[model samples]
Target: MTIKEKEEEVIEEFSFFEDWMAKYEYIIDLGKNLNGYPPEQKTPENIIKGCQSQVWLHAYMDGEKLIYKADSDALISKGLISLLVGVLSDQTPADILSNKLKFIEEIGLNEHLSPNRSNGLSSMIKTMKAYAIAFSK
Candidate 1:
């Protein structure tokens, strides 16, 4: 789906649930829908370092915008990465670099996550954002 449509869907789902349990479930479901990366695409070159879970991410410039493809071995981690991609994919590198992922906190997920999980997610996001910076340079 288009980012706008996905955003609308997220907002609508949030409107209905308004509770963290429901929101977390929705996020997990969203992750379940993440497209898988072919074995060839999940090469060492594409691997995102520092995540506790195995993550592979590839980013390329499409015209003036950056597009991303990513995956992870762990289920919820995959979903978390999908959530990050949903939040930042298709936008300009500059946009991705400028806007903080404030939604994680706003959604009340950050505080509930274990310290290690939070760090792993942070590392994944940092790698993605760093790629945007690299591509934009």
Candidate 2:
């Protein structure tokens, strides 16, 4: 399925969980399945700033869409990054630029996150947006 379709599916699945903890667990599990960067590509250049845990992200344009790979030292954070990337990857620059990831707030993760995590999340979003901007140019 397309990333957008998968994201909608996840949102639907999350809506089925009664407890917020269960939703968090589901997100973490999603992260566990993400394809991380190769050891060789794990460098400062690719590292995402503002995250409490070390996170690395890389993006490349494949035809009309942006492809992404990312990793984090912390398991839950890795999952968070994975979820973000999963939702945003494989999208064309214009689609990504116009799309708003309301799911973060819709699932109520934003209010529950620590200040640092929120900063990291913003940084991650900035990174993804920056990639789209650069590729579009």
Candidate 3:
């Protein structure tokens, strides 16, 4: 599926939750289902700066698309990254760079998060876009 399609799917899925608590449970499930990053790739370079918890993100170009792998020590953070990767991965670098990731706001993810986690989410988005920018060049 395209990025927009994936994002819409996530938005629809989140819409089913009756409250933030249920939404959080859904997010935690996403984290648990994440295809974890390799131990070897958790280098300093892969570690995302500005996040309170350790988050390692790695990306490479696949033909014209970008493929991402990531892990976070925190469950919520892991789920957040997995959500992002699910929506943004396997897309062209230009597409990723141009995306604003409105799903976060659409699903009320940012509002429900703690300040630190909110910042970490932003950091993850920045890191992903930076990778896209670099790879697009």
Q: Global lDDT of each model?
A: 0.77, 0.83, 0.91
**Candidate 3 wrong stretches, greater than 4 Å:** none
CA shift of 39, model 1, Å = 3.0
Instruction: Please list the residue runs of candidate 2 whose C-alpha ends up more than 4 Å from where it truly belongs after superposition.
Output: 1-6
Ranking by TM-score: 3, 2, 1
RMSD of each: 2.9, 1.8, 1.0
State residue 103's C-alpha deviation in candidate 3, in Å: 0.6
Give the Cα-based TM-score of candidate 3 against the true structure.
Answer: 0.96
Q: Model 1 clash tally?
A: 0
Model 1 CA lDDT for position 66: 87
Score every model by TM-score.
0.82, 0.90, 0.96
lDDT of 3 by residue, 1-137 (tens): 88889999999999999987899899998888897688899899999998999999999898999999999888888999999999999999999987677899999988888888899999999999999999987
| lDDT score for residue 73 of model 1 | 76
Badly placed stretches (over 4 Å) of model 1 are 1-12, 18-21
- Backbone clash pairs for candidate 2 read 31-79
Worst lDDT run of 10 residues, candidate 3, spans: 94-103
